[model samples]
Target: MMKHQIARVLVLVSIAGTCLSTASCQKTDPNRKETIPVCGEVYVDGQPAAMLQIQCHPVEGMDTQQPTITQAVTDQEGKFQLATYEAGDGAPVGEYKLTFVWQNFSAVAASYSGPDKLKKRYADPGKSPFPLRVEKGKQVDLGRIELSTK
Candidate 1:
């Protein structure tokens, strides 16, 4: 009958629409799920260093610099976390120069000794320098810093 034909046509159209919708929803690629973290950590000479505490410069000769990334201080186990940016997080993605400066001082020498030379000379911290390259959005695990007494 004419009524039966019309009902069958309507049902077929609905099924087709449903199938198309489902297919479109299922077409998302697995690769699109990649994302970046908002933070991370750093290490120096096998000791966990504070994030953003170690200054990082993106380039040289630009005459510009960035702030230390805020990071948790290393725990007793020497563990830390680094900064992260979400996928498409609009953060600058590239290379950086990680700089660590040890500015040790002699409090007793500074107070008592008029001549700084006679005081015992240890790692000045002012002289201890650590520099490295870091790739953004990549894990930079600095295993150790082998320093020389010389």
Candidate 2:
């Protein structure tokens, strides 16, 4: 009877430890903010700006929940899907200062390059004129954004 009781206690302790570890792994912080899907298209010189990165910076007074920045890369069709914590998971609903960057010089040369295409000013978030607000549970569509060299 003593041996049986000891075995039962060991089993219970193992189960309790497993349960605690599993719960801890999936722990959620109270400070975590909700996120929504954000989608947009980028255009340069009236054409699709494919394979470019779009970084969304959290702006003060616009993002009261959390200051988590999100980013997405444009597809071949100039479409992008924003991601915050995961791939294509979107971002927290708030206003964001958008910055565009195209670092792939080889890809740029293969696709299209002109005086109206690559503009360095558009890559600076502080100097960029693009500002967007993402709505919760709603898809925000940023229409054709033209970047001009002039």
lDDT of each: 0.40, 0.77
Estimate the overall C-alpha local distance difference test score of candidate 1: 0.40
- RMSD in order of candidates: 13.0, 4.9
In TM-score terms, which candidate is top? 2
Candidate 2 error regions (>4 Å): 61-66, 105-117, 143-150
Pairs in steric clash, model 2: none
For lDDT, the strongest prediction is 2
Candidate 2 lDDT by residue in tens digits, 24-90: 9899766777778878788776778787878887666345545566899888888888888878888
Error of 2 at 123 (Å): 2.3
lDDT for residue 27 in candidate 1, whole number 0-100: 88
Write one digit per residue (lDDT tens) for candidate 1, span 86-115: 322222334444443333334566422233
